[model samples]
Target: MPNILNLQSLLGLAVIVGACWAVSENRRAFPWKLAIGAVLVQAALVLLVFGVPGSAVVLNAITGAVDGLATATRRGTQFIFGYLAGGEQPYVVQNQPALFVFAFEVLPLILVISALSALLWHWKILKWITRGFGLLFQRTMGLGGASALAVAANIFLGMIESPIVIRAYLDKLTRSEVFLMMVVGLATVAGSTMVAYATILGPVLPNAAGHVLVASIVSAPAGILLARIIIPETPGEGGAHADYDSDLKYDSAIDAIVKGTADGLMVVLNISAVLIVFVALVALVNVMLGGFWLFDGPVTVERVLGWLFAPVAWLIGVEWSEAGRAGWLLGVKLTLTEFVAFIELGNIPAGEMSERTRMLMTYAVCGFANIGSVGITVTGLSVLMPERRQMVLDMVWKALFAGFLATLMSAAVVGALPGAVFGT
Candidate 1:
């Protein structure tokens, strides 16, 4: 592992905040109180989940629960698809790793999780949880009810789907509030994707489910902090109270399952299509660049990305020695998608990177902030409120920057904490 007391990460925290300050729209109107509060709230959440007594037990239980759900998902997949989905095969396999196929085994988990999530939403279990967090955000961060609710829902519903909850208030939200929602949306992953990520990283990191979930939760406040810095709120610019009525309604439990399954199908197909195309494109580019060689390696896409983002990796407390690979993952995440980057991270040989670096990279790339997502978010919001399309376009690029930095900020916090906090 890297240094238990990573002092450099403390500097990183300052640098990240300074970078956000440098991009402030209203430098004079800096949200000093919000900045301090957001960071404090994030730290308190981390301590409550990891550092406090009995926290590890709870986290372990979450991990076990996630693993159990994955197992349950496999049973469904296997029953449906037979040996292709990791059921007993008639023929013996020589290679153990090759037995588990991503499309057949991993992607199906999204479908199961999505249906379950929809059911939970219909049952009001997820809503109350979202409301609790929303209220917390409203109280601590001084966010309006609509903005707070949107950010809280973004943790579970994802960027594109999150706006649906606030669709009624989109026109009412101020420019700053919309941008905050966008930044937070981009900075976090959805509940449906959480299990898939955990399954992918399971071999590489222990308690992978807990780590994935914590990364999303931890980054929420970081998103708030950076969004406020980039576009500080003007006085009397937002609705003080939100109705909290959801536009996402279901006729019944079965209706929710059917609708959620349809949504999950689209998600699974999109992911499958994107991965197929993106991975092939990367390979094609690598083949084209295969002849060129840098000082120690070939000038491939990963190497190029590593060169571009190595400094960011270092800033997040990865050692200089492992920063190149870490940077490559970050770049892949930004350019391609987090799914592609995570698959690459899982592909890396064990023991080549330190546990600290692996953990930091996991948190660093745990956001939906990527090139593809920018289009999805802008287009989705535009569809939700056609009148606000221009405004959405105007601030989206900046929100992307803030959102990406938000995830990095979470990694920085992780780095600054003691190694024992993660049981390392």
Candidate 2:
């Protein structure tokens, strides 16, 4: 394993902060105290999850629970799709690699988790927990009420759904507050997609589910830090409307389930469609580039992306020799979706990279920060606050950079910790 107590990670952290400051809206008006507070909060979460005594026990339990949920989802899929969905085969196995179907075995988890998340929300179970975190963000990060609540809720909700938690206050937010909300939304993953990612990454990383959960949780503060650096809050901004009450509602548990299932269906179909098109396009691109040779091999998209982002990979604590592969994955995550990047990550052969590098890359790519998400965010936020649509469009690209840097900062934090914290 690579050295987890890497001093280069400290340099990476400084470079990230400096990069943000270099493009800051108001360089002289930096929120010094808020920046420190955000880093401290992320450090506390990292220690609690990976360093605290008996954290492994708690993490194992969480992982087991998530795995059990996946099992239950598989059972449902098997009933509907029969042998193709991981059920017993009538004939002898011929192609073991082709046995598992992504549509039948994996996508169903989105439906189940979405329904469960909706049910939990109706029970006010998640709402109260979200409120608790909202208050924490407000108090510790000194964010205005609505931004804090939205950031807190983004840990478990989708980018669009999170802002809906503070929908009523969207128009009331200052320019900086609105940008912060957008940054955090892109920096975190939604609960509905969390299990699917865990299932994909389970073979690559231990406690995969727990790591995905912690990635979202820790990225929130990093998002705040980066967003503040890019767009500092104006003096005497609005803070009186720190309400956490959400306008989202359902008539009953059954209604919530139905709505959630419908939403999940859209998500599943969208993912399926995107993957199909993107993968095909990539193949076509590779075919076009097949004639070109570089380093005594055919030049492909992965190689080009690897060369482009290798520095970023090294900056986030990957070894120089492995940085090319790591950079390709990072580039894919930024240009394509994280789902595609993760699928590629899972395809890498065992022993190809150190455990530390795998863990660092996991944190680095675990977010909704991609070119596609930019349109989704702009359209979603525009519908919620039409009056501020122009402002959102203007600042959203900056928010994307902030979100991207936020995940890298999370990876840098993980890299800075001692190897013993993770038992690597």
Candidate 3:
């Protein structure tokens, strides 16, 4: 079948966007022009990268680079962690399917990408790219320069470090603009984290890096649109671009690499700890819940979530048959973290879910919108703008919802994209 955007996808997009609009804070003042334009832009980018021949070639090359980087990361892991890191001359456990060595192989990529991102920033290449995108966002979205720049920085620096890019504008930003930035932060993953996810999902989805990148790009504008709807912009706000300052200056290239590596190490420890505790707690809860029987015997938290959110899964483009499983992954992502969700998605039984479901789930789970994020984003942004703490606290939950919708919007678009993009 030639991959074309069919009626099913168009309805899904409209339903999802309309749902967001329905619950908008000021529905009377919604931004109709921006919403339509953003969706059109998202559709064009999706078709271009996934459908257009010239663009797919470029996307494939980028995905190739990311895949090679993952391989390189494994090599580094082997050199440092030896057989435990999936080296040659491996023992039984070492050679096993990513069971024991999953963290060893995947988590370290955070460190590598962080250092690489820092190096790019130090050379101002990252700055130029982010600022250019910020400019586009500023003009296209009709957003304040500060918020747009921060949104662009989120592509690489993530929700936490991204606020630093617009630290100066935090105080001046109106309530609506602040919430929009928060929504964008939650909708996208940092470049470092994207590498981590790409490493895990590379085998499951074609062009993992490209999909993750596209997910962020598509969701960002959606986040802004959603935010605007939920809480319409106050009169006279988010107009004109502000002078951007990346606030990411490093003393030297080596300095960036070293600092970024150190930051990556901290993140690795953080991820390791979170996973250890979160997984254990989930098991404990499941044990209690497992006592109850469903048709399939003892039920676990995941199964319950699968059933509860199955409709959500289906609406995002998964088939009705696979909705439960996709919803399970979505639940894990929202409750635990996208990291744990992707790890679990990589382990799904082969042929249990269709290829399309797996690909859509990959896009759906590629953000930082969990409950854990609400506090992290609040604290991170608060460090720069303490005065906005009360306001951030007030809007945190709504931001999370907007972020979730934004990512799901991206997933629908990707799922609707013609499979021809992947040579399917």
Off by over 4 Å in 3: 1-5, 90-95, 98-100
Question: For model 2, what is the error of residue 271's alpha carbon versus the real structure, in angstroms, after optimal superposition?
Answer: 1.2
- Per-prediction TM-score to the true structure, in the order listed: 0.97, 0.97, 0.94
Ranking by lDDT: 1, 2, 3
Error of 3 at 204 (Å): 2.2
Q: Which residue pairs in model 1 clash with each other?
A: none
lDDT of 1: 0.89
lDDT of 1 by residue, 1-424 (tens): 5463377776777888899999899888888898788777877787788888988788889888888888998898899889888798889888877888999777988998899899999999999999999999998888999999999999998798888988878888899999999999999999999989988988888777888888999899999999999999899788546877889889999999999988998899988988899889999999999999988888999899999999888888889888899999999999889999888888887789888898998899999999888988888998898898999999999999999999999999888888888887
Per-residue CA lDDT of model 3 for 126-221, tens digit only, reads: 999999989988888888888889888887777888887776667778888888889999998888888778777777676777877887777788
**How high is the lDDT of residue 194 in model 1?**
90
lDDT tens per residue, model 2, 1-424? 5364477776788899999999997999888898788888988898898789999888998889888999999999999988989798888998988987889867899999988888888889998999999999989988788888899899998999988888888878888888989999999999998888888888878878877888889999999999988988888986637667888777999999998888889889988988898888888999999999999999999899999999988988888999999999999999888989888887786688788888888899999999889999999988999888899899989999999999999998888878777888
Query: Which of the two candidates, 2 or 3, achieves a greater TM-score against the reference?
Result: 2
The local distance difference test score of model 3 is: 0.82
Q: In terms of lDDT, which candidate is stronger, 1 or 3? A: 1
Q: Which ten residues in a row have the lowest lDDT in candidate 1?
A: 1-10
